[model samples]
Target: MSENLFVKWTILPQEPPQPLLYCKRCGGTRNFRSSGKIRVNANGKRVDAWLVYKCMSCDGTWNRPVLERQSVRSIDPLLLASLCANDAKLADRLAFDVEGLRRWAPHLKEASNAVVARELLSETPARPLELRILCVVPCHMALRLDRLLADELRIPRSRIHALEKSGALVVFPSASRALRKPVRDGTKLLIRPPAEDADWIARSAAYGDDCP
Candidate 1:
């Protein structure tokens, strides 16, 4: 049996989704920006919370509900305090919550286009390297797997296509158009490098280093 090596890579998408809403003050649809403020209200034993957003053009305020009426005692005091204090980190994280934003604004635009950070998480050494790629998307975005690999591996796109054609690279849940498709989490790629490039590929796999 051929030796099997394993390497794990993680891809993190870095960008926040923007809310597209109709600004009453502006009299047209415009993007809204996160105000980093949480509005909280308490009535008897119940509490309500909302994430505040403001129209970019007119600064009109819109409240995105974070929580409906609920028992105050059931909520974490620290989280409640963070909401009252307008925690920047919490607000920033919520800015990426596209699903939440969609409830308030039917059409939301992304503040920035998706960019990725590639990280080599782990590797088990052996003769042939089977790479496991985990893609963590904070928002709804699409990027081709081939381009990502080409850039991360410092290899040419044609080389990747050629390898796939020759059976040197095998994608799990294999799709004929896998390379062109958007990458999803838990995708596995098994690579059996050709004899000519085995040593170079092995070195790259061992170090998880991009070509210089």
Candidate 2:
């Protein structure tokens, strides 16, 4: 109806995905979390490294290989040093690797928990009629797009669906089942509401303190 009020939402997943593996002590499959420890072994010119994982149920441990007898010459010295020193950031990044976690277990119990950092990318209007949200994900997280919007807007997913049904909410640059699936980078949403509802939704989208 007017120049869109553009806003950016940066989402960061809080927890890493847990790999479910059978634990003999627990007598069943259990989730394993990263121990934030790295083990490196160097034999001649070959190097092997792993990120340690611990079973949540029994304190049992598993090692996820980061390097497999790689040639020292082929590896970056900095990366090798980080692996040896047990760099927390490097370990966290590796631990959050959902695709890599698939090696141990095809299915993972991924956390939907995340924090959204919002910013206004365009000028605010006195009576805003349109709001566009741009989702920015630094790393892959398992949070659904609708869940994210509901969380930030402080509303129920059912309300979001209602808006969609009324043609007030439009999700673009997305495929089918976008709402049910995990949020991805560059996902955009356009919201157009009646004049009376525009101000409230805009404030909520921008996280205004006065929002209902």
Give lDDT tens digits, candidate 2, residues 102-185. Answer: 886786888799877889888777778788999898777889888887877776899888888788888887577677789988
Most TM-score-accurate candidate? 2
Q: So what's the TM-score on candidate 1?
A: 0.70
> Model 1 clash pairs?
none
| CA lDDT of each prediction against the hidden true structure | 0.70, 0.85
Which prediction has the highest lDDT against the true structure?
Answer: 2
Clashes (backbone N, CA, C under 3 Å), per candidate, total 0, 0
Residue 168 error for model 1, in Å?
A: 3.3
**Where does candidate 1 stray beyond 4 Å?**
1-5, 56-59, 110-130, 136-140, 156-159, 193-212
| Model 2 per-residue lDDT at 106 | 84
Q: After the best TM-score superposition of candidate 1, give how far the Cα of residue 150 lies from its true spot, in angstroms.
A: 3.0
86: Cα error in model 2, Å: 0.7
